[model samples]
Target chain A: MKNHVQWESSLFELIRRTSVDLPCDIEQGLRRACKTEKKSSRARWILEALLENVQKARDNDAPLCQDTGSLIFYFQVPVGFDTNALASATRLAVARATRLGYLRQNTIDSVSGSACATNVAYGAPTFYFEQCARGTVDVRLLMKGGGCENVGKQYSLPAESLGAGRDLEGVRRCVLDAVVSAQGNGCAPGILGVCIGGDRATGYECSKSQFLRKLDDKSPVKILARLEDRLLKESKVLEIGPMGLGGNTALLGLKIGSMSRVPASFFVTVSYMCWAFRRRGAVLTVRGGFKKWLY
Target chain B: MALLKPRRLEYPFTPEQVGSLRAGQFVLVSGLVYTARDRIHKYFFDGGKSPVDLKNAALYHCGPVVIRKDSDWVVRAAGPTTSIREEPYLPRIIKDHGVRVIIGKGSMGKVTEGACKAGGCVYLHAVGGAAQVLAEKVVSVKGLYFGEEFGLAEAMWVLELKDFPAIVAIDSKGHNLLRRVKSASLRMGRKLMKSSDPFIP
Candidate 1:
């Protein structure tokens, strides 16, 4: 609360960790996928390359992917906390992280196509702040690359092409369609974060938020949790494998969340995440000091 | 039904060598590779000239993490980006620059395959997010172009590589490995969706 410089430093550390290190669950998913493929197979080779890259990035303290992706932050704090201060601190941390090579200069002008060297332009680092009763601060970050973002798809229900209706069957079909179309383009052995029953904009936002969850963490809703597992198991049948060369492991995880929607709209939003899957969180103490890292 | 051994490639390679390579083959590429992404491709599509010659060279679709160290630019993470996004501009770039091999993640479309076949160029699929591993293969950052104008990610970075890993996803013979994978998956996907198994909500 008193030392502004220290707070910024703590945020910088969070940003750096999120960029350079691959979380254990994701790394384990890759390792497990590597074992499933045949010896010396293309899928195995690709998995090995990814695992090897993960280690090298951590050991060298380098950004895992050159993209360093879009910096999306979720801040949950107590009602009385100063939100504006935290936002400014985060923006400073992002720019410093870029300069120190933890993050690449990735933001660009939509009008001119020029790069934002500092990655601090308006709407560059997206922040979502909400008040929580926990009386603490939790900042979560997801570095989603452009490649996978380009592959994210949204489907409207009652589609003749898929025979998808306004039900779970429809959601499943839409997800399968998304993965099938993405193939290896979105980077297979990927993860799918889905949102059902939300409006067009909120649908994608909710789906992306699912990436903040651990690979093994099921949704609180029992049906959604079961769907998550079923979707993952079915993805292997697609046989897209890692980077789409074809293998046993098609997807690592699938998470689905839902929001209340108007009767007229039944949108299924699918947010595709590449195997890189860089997501990290930090819990701050009551006095605005770093408490612990939340994977 | 692919070979275990990785075929070694040196950049500025010939048409015959590129033609001989088939889809689904693993390759360890070495030598001069040029990095370019959406902006550079758009530049070329708009008839902008390349400062460095791209004829018969390895064109990597990457926006690498490079920084200055004692006056020399160093590549920290130089993994491939998704290639499909560049499809609109690739055919023209291949025609204009005579680009020998295209390196990136994911599969491209019909026109890219046709252009590769006609131009005798091949598409190489590098591990999508293996930037640090790929950067390790980059022995040196030789030169840069359009750094100021296009920004770091969009600029053309000339890299000297050694034993960089990739696979031949689209060969010069009009064969596309990624496309084949997608089509087969599509059949399975159709069957799965049509199955009787239902998720009881």
Candidate 2:
């Protein structure tokens, strides 16, 4: 069995990099959004400030945002790998990261509404473990903040109000409604990960997992790919702009996927991410050393 | 029209001073501000007594990132939390605490706007997700209340700020930028949806 300490160290580096660095694709998306706005617009300036903050955080090795958010680790391991040992290592890494100030102490007990200083609340640092046939392990990390999480919405389709059914067009309308409601609330010029079908909980789960995809990647399904592009454009046309100040760019990216659902339920779930899209990945060597960083 | 510069606001200000501020204008706040989140607002609205006097103070809807240094706490990153979460409690907090300004990210609701007008307060919007930039303006951590019980995010942190930057989103006159944007965006959304021009093709 691989030493748990090595896995813990790998997780620490992953958390640190995820906190400090804004991925190139997201940065590029912001740049493209910036160009579409006028020179004197608040949207433009907000993007500029965001870009500068990204650089400053990298230089200073500080937390990107005050709310480091819930640490979600997605792991793909070989069939024979020690799953329990890996889970323990991840928890230890999260605790170490919090103590080292790479992550903020953010977990809370929903019942008592009290802080769990260690950030290892019962359901927090959400883990998704997938066993693969390959020998190596792959880990992807996404830090989802509460502000954006609050704006996430799930819609039951075949609604008369939006003229939406269970089709791709229905998904289009549902996603737009979410964007409009969000306004500047979820921190505008955000990224959206949408799941077109599934039950309520799984829809949200599947939607959040889409954040692991690269910002520029299009859905493999031709129709879903087109919908992604359409949503991105419609989001820009809303004039909610950045911080709802009004401008040409309102959304940075849109990612959509579908899941088989029961006939009665046609759930479309959307997960909103603020401009600070903190996600990163790493491929680990057999000994648990970082083989390479994935953006 | 020229861009509105950030008006300087210090603590112990009058309602008229706050009333004079308009929505869409920027402001630089200096002096003492207290940090409070959803829990603390609930505490105040639930008839909890104030541990410290809050008259004419600026209340920031922020859950700051702080670390223990030697014996005291040092603020590493401090940014505004979503203000809408505290909507139900804001009006009462403004009235009961004599709060001159409510600072946070995003915008509050009609209740908050009405409260700002009636109670003589303004809502300020700090740039969301810009924690490191905002932390630079926090000169010192003056003190903390309920830190042990509420934890770092929910605690009432007394902070000394120097030229803290924010935009006036909801003014005392009931001029709410957020409200205006909502209506405008709703109209725009309808118009764009009508085109059916296949934005992607």
Candidate 3:
């Protein structure tokens, strides 16, 4: 038997914090971007208003955005831990959170298109569990919004269009195309996660997983770190600005990761996350107490 | 073109009131606004009558977070959804409802622009992703329709609004701010793509 009660309560708190609180690093990035823009520009004004909204939501303990988004949980556990128990606990916690209004009832039945008020419909609250050498259980949650999700793109490289080849240059073109296409629709000041090589589904998954890294963290690979910096600087030139109004600062952060691929295929997937990037995690001890908080 | 000053207007606006709004201007709307998304729009397209009067009313494109209190419904977070998704049905909705103002984010398409001109309606762009701040303007929920069927997010929420701020993204005169941004950004992207800067394709 597992500690259902304690785990449920802790997961509820995690959901609450993830929905209401803006992570410190992302907040800092917004503040920095706000300073560099023209004082009277729309980008600056939008950032200012957003920072205020963040404060208001936190102070009032209210959800930061109306679209609480699809709740996705990523769990890493010790080899011998029971994955089924953890998944069940997560479902119960999601249900409780929906009832308590910590999260909006976002899950729906795809076929029937009915609102599953419990937010625990089939395949809802997507879970990814993996076994690791560590003894502690680490769970991360990300609230992926629909608008941004709609804008995510995948490119099969070595293409004649845009004169892109199956190279790092091709990846750069693919990501830029996505940012340009999204314009103001995906909500500006977007954070992007780019995966250079993988199959279609796994490529998108890997791209979204890159969002777990802190906004300022540098990629261990020198070339990828350089690409991240370059893309971050170049995306501003698109001038999509905040809310798609004309100004500076189109993107706040860009994370790049790559995986090995078959010689015949070169795939690049780009995942866009809106400014309201709600993501948080915690390490839970067996007793269900928070061992530590992860950004 | 000169920038128009932001205006404040109440519900039941006339064609003249809508004509006065130009793209790039701001507006603060007060009074009652009806909320509907994908499903409710389809409902209207399928010949379903609007539960409430929409004559010269502001139609908001949103799926709000509403919770039922003791007996009343409270809007916890009321932010605008992307407007482009409703492009196929907007022209008809504007014509049928006699809607003067359509509030949403991400400016609609050419069809909507033409409809706004023909129907004498204006597209008001709300701040995207600012649900809590937007919810503050929703004073109260008058009532709700389709909650049991389409779910809370897709239901038609009748809300009483006070000083709801938005920008005139597309005006009755056919000017569109979002279109301008998109074209300008595309041009810039092309220019950047052609450059010899190693990152460019």
Candidate 4:
């Protein structure tokens, strides 16, 4: 077995490095969007400024943007592993990473109005654990910034509005409304992860889980598969183009996931992701070695 | 050729000049503008309070930003916050105060638009997240209005600015570049989607 201290140190190091730099996909997307949007002077200017900010952040080792975001950790643990020890070690790792990351202490007293710069709150480093038969642990770190998080919305559309069988059109309307309503607050040319057919809580959870999927991953389920195809087509139609400037691309991608819902309800939820979708992941072995997985 | 040179503007700007201004048109404004945000807006609107003479003045949608000495405030970083948050109360505030320009990021909704058209005012969008860059434009930090009890960051600050850069995001003519851009993009999107195999081919 590998030493827990070594594992914790490695995790902290990975978190610190990823926080200050723009992820490769985000960088590529922005560059490509900028090139395609040259005619749009406003879009080009804002995008160039954003790109400049990214470079400055990376060079200076600053948090990529002012809103460093809340930390979300996803853990995939091996079956038969000692979960208790892992949890404690993970907490220590997070606390150490928070200190070294020089991240803005965002946690504050919501009611009492006190500030906690350490980024550790009552339920911070929000953990979602999944047990698998594999003999290794996989961890994913996602810093969901507030600007994008605020635009997330969940709705239960009437079954009749979609269609007699399944109102796919209603789903389309809700998604369009959500993006249009968001305007530029969530930062335009954003990504959206949508969940269809789950109960209220699962609907929201699945919406977020879809963000974890690879940008290129194809949907596995049929309804979500169709919805994804249609929503992507219609989102650009809303004209909330890049950076909320008029452009050819309003959204980078539309990802969808679905779950069983009650016969009477058609629940659809959306989680918006800003241009800087800061996330990283790693796979950990029992031998104390790990490989960075998500970027 | 350069598109247009930046111009410095002041209060009592003519209707003709305001009409020429379009959302997304950049301008350098020099004048006295008040800094107010959520807390001050609520206090003024709800608390039955009036602090400044509102006629022909500008109300910035900002919670700028200061550090302290023994008895005074010094601005550290003052920039525009997102403007859409104040859409609920902006029209009333503009009418009540006879305010002219509402400066912030993003676009305000229909209510503010109607108020701007009716009240002969405009909405300006400062670049979001450009706090440090925008701070260079402020010539002086004038004084505070209220909410000092709240904190340095959240208080109502009265700022004296010169050559403050901004874009008219929503104008007196009801021309909103944000809305225009969205409409144009949506129309193009429908056409593109209607065509078969429209995936960047």
Q: Give me the candidate number with maximum lDDT.
A: 1
lDDT of 2 by residue, A1-295 (tens): 5777888888888999998889999999988888888875677777887887788788878887898998888999988888788888888889888897888889888888777767886888898999999878999999989999999999998977877787777778788889989998888778899998989899999999999899989999998898888778778778898877677667888999899999899999999999889999999976788888898
Docking class for model 3 is medium
Q: What DockQ does model 4 achieve?
A: 0.21
Better of 2 and 4 by DockQ: 2
| lDDT tens readout by residue for model 4, A1-295 | 2488877776676566656666777778778878866553666666666676567656655556444567777888887777667666666776775555435445656887655645667877677888998887888777776767888888777534323134655566567667776766676667888887888888987888777776656688766676777777677556566557555556777887778888888888889887767777778786446754566
Off by over 4 Å in 2: B196-201
DockQ of each: 0.78, 0.58, 0.58, 0.21
Candidate 1 segments whose C-alpha is farther than 4 A from its true place: none
Q: Tens-digit lDDT track for model 2 on B14-94?
A: 776787898988778899999999889999999898888899898999998888899988877788899888999988888
lDDT of 4: 0.68
Model 1 clashes, total count: 0
lDDT of 4 by residue, B117-194 (tens): 987788887655444445556777777766544444456677777777666778897777777765665555445434
RMSD of each: 1.4, 1.7, 1.7, 5.4
TM-score: model 2 vs. ground truth: 0.96
Q: Assess the local accuracy of residue A162 in candidate 1 as a C-alpha lDDT between 0 and 100.
A: 96
Candidates' lDDT values, in order?
0.88, 0.85, 0.86, 0.68
Instruction: Provide the lDDT at A61 for model 3.
Output: 86
In angstroms, what RMSD does candidate 3 have relative to the true structure?
A: 1.7
